[model samples]
Target: SGMLITGVTTLLLSLLVLALAWWASIRGAQMRSSLPPGPTPLGLLGNLLQLEFGGLDRALMKVAQTLSRNWGPIFTVWLGPRPAVVLCGYAALRDALVLQADTFSGRGAMPVFQRFTRGNGIVFSNGPRWRTLRNFALGTLKEFGMGTRSIEEHIMEEAACLLGEFQATNGTPLDPQRLLDNAVSNVICSAVFGKRYGYEDPEFLRLLELFNDNFRIMSSRWGEVYNIFPSLLDWLPGPHHQIFQNFEELRTFISEQIQQHQETRKFGEPHDFIDCFLDQMDKVLAPQDPESHFQEETLVMTTHNLFFGGTETTSTTLLCLTDSCPAQVQAELDAVVGRARAPCLEDRVRLPYTNAVLHEIQRFISVLPLGLPRALTRDTHLRSHFLPKGTMVIPLLVSAHRDPTQFKDPDCFNPTNFLDERGEFQSNEAFMPFAPGKRMCLGAGLARSEIFLFLTAILQKFHLLPVESPSNIDLTPQCTGLGNVPPAFQLRLMAR
Candidate 1:
């Protein structure tokens, strides 16, 4: 019994000693690493308490704003023990992404991402794989009629079906979100898989709900902690487990689709994303040097990337776009675009109120609030501050969108920011919801087309009726899974 007690005591002491050594090692290196000044970290805890107040992005915005006002464009913060520089304002963001693109070449990978995606997808991979996959996906999108009439026609057909679904709601208060999600998801799914499901499709509905639930749970302190102490979470039980499981469920669905495609192999001439992937596989797999990552694994992850990244972002932005706009935007759409035309991408030029409203929603909503964390590829200087290689740099995208210096009324949901006196859509360089530079969203063009077409379609066919007084619909967004999801609200779709 005495020996047993001694062994337990020794084990505890050893763990404590190792932890101290590990922590000391981290602090000494981080302290020496050349970066701009930041708030002092509290040992292992870092400045987590400060950044995690309400939300990580919100707290980062507050920190970035305060420092940029005093510290200028470039400033640093400690996310746990890791030192992260906050690149605030549009000018600095543009410079880093556009001018100093090579310095910020790598997208920082998080522990949560590693757990969920297994480094198999385009969203996080770096170097040759990332470049190849991104190019391939972009090419695939083009082949599938991303900008052409072929793809636009598919979106138009889906939009028509979506309008019909909304009309069936019979003026009763219906959640515009689900109908909108159905429409948007169908667009991407059709583009990726070469088929679209009905609004009532159970399998498709489950996929939407999985992503929705994952998004909900991912935006909390849980996600922040996952980003930092991912190794520690493996020892303890938590929500991230379920989140990973949900992601796996999604991956499983994607894998099955790939299998179905494989059985009937016509990949050399891809009609959609999956077919394009197969074509890439055949081209890359040479007889002499046959080392290829472009296979079933890549195909599955690519589809997942397209569906997961493409769908929620497009849908959430649409939801926010509607929420931010006044009823008058819809009324104006009805007056100008009218029901007979079937709102098209080209119509945004004539639909001043609608275009302004879309831009405002993107700016205000800020889908990627903290922006994706980027890793410094090499030692670099930004605004006279030295950033060390491998340091996680949080691009203050949310802050930039609403920066007081950049926008006229930064806090308000004013669509006029994007409109001239003539009410024609005039864009500002500062307004970058899809982010900027080399790592900018690959689907930016497709998303723009989708948003323009979807909104135009709905507005043309039906008027956005608010539940009760429309005043009850919340503007406060639900921060989840690295995004700001729209609040729970319903819209009654009155047929035009």
Candidate 2:
């Protein structure tokens, strides 16, 4: 009887503990944003369980499409306990991004963006710092011949090296992704500092490795957690902190390069980005003028941003485009642009069908499915919904590009949308592959030059070999963090 009484008491205590924990979890969900319609949240976990953490891009699109159909172009969803209003389709996105540009000006430094960048860089910084850095980068690119012969020459060099690498492979099956990443990123690196690293360079390899880590970590589900629960994460070591440490090492390397340029001190000729920066630093650091936007901090941050922002994005887009498009694109490209001619921006104009294919790849794959996670600069009204300042806004690029009303089949890979009835190239306003507005890709001109040139260069040399294999290509994008993808795979290069 005594043992039975002890057993009963222990059982009741265990039951009570579980019940209390359950109640706390349920009650923890306090955020009740009635701004727009979305799936119901579950307790303290919120809507996290609703997401397809394994395959994010597909999951996001499915939810976005369903929500848009039911709620129209604007809807709100919980990213954990936090409420975010996502903009569906281009009309809504453009209204928010372009017309209401200033109102959506702030790129609120989420905990992760803040910890990694300290709000120093262009990708994360807001307010006057962002404006100044952006304007300076713009002017610097112009001085460095972003659209002129200089940038063209830099791209051609990288292209030539890439072509040599592919030709050396002699029609073997190889993943051209890393080589392409290195080649494309090296262009920005060369511009920033007057050096083109050899393929085997240890530092260059490490930098690539670091960027890849950031890419995987940035787009993962846990990344969202870190962004939200920074206070908790700060106490313990986590991927967010590790990533920041690694990224700072990258910044340190750039700082060393800047120091070298300063010591050498050749401002008049302006050999590269560093040289130009040194020249500006001289003027900005004058005794007469104390407070300056251009400082060692800005220089390091801007350099870091360019390397971080300019690299992985362009490389990933190209990698996915090649994977998403049919192998026949290579043959079609070969017939249009011969091997004797070098691929240029002009080639994109000449090869209408190839251009169409490229455009479609960009449209269907849509790497930045959510575009950049934006923060409202002020309380604003859109589609009759009120969005308060600091609310996370996602411009839904995937939904807009795949809207059936815009294209015959928004989901299918048809190049006809980019081609006219007469088989000429046509431009669509609906296609904002890089996302639009003030925060649109800073390296737009440079990225365009590289993509068109690199794709044409490869096609001029090799045919993308088709297979008797099953559809290895999944136009479905895999989002590890906030990014989505064309499913991961490799290709074979055959000489035409």
Candidates in order: C-alpha RMSD to true structure: 2.6, 4.5
| Candidate 2 error regions (>4 Å) | 1-34, 42-44, 54-57, 147-149, 235-241, 287-290, 318-336, 466-470, 474-479, 485-488
lDDT of each: 0.76, 0.74
Candidate 1 lDDT over residue span 191-289, tens digit each: 887788888989999988987777776776676677788888877788867788898898899888877777886756555677777777777788765
lDDT of 2 by residue, 157-241 (tens): 8999988888888776777768888898889878888778877789999888887777677777666677655776788766666
For model 1, the stretches where C-alpha displacement exceeds 4 angstroms are 1-22, 25-33, 146-149, 320-327
Model 1 Cα shift for residue 439 (angstroms) = 1.0
Per-candidate total of colliding backbone pairs: 2, 7
TM-score of each candidate structure, all chains considered together: 0.93, 0.87
| Ten-residue stretch with the least lDDT total in model 2 | 25-34
Best by TM-score: 1
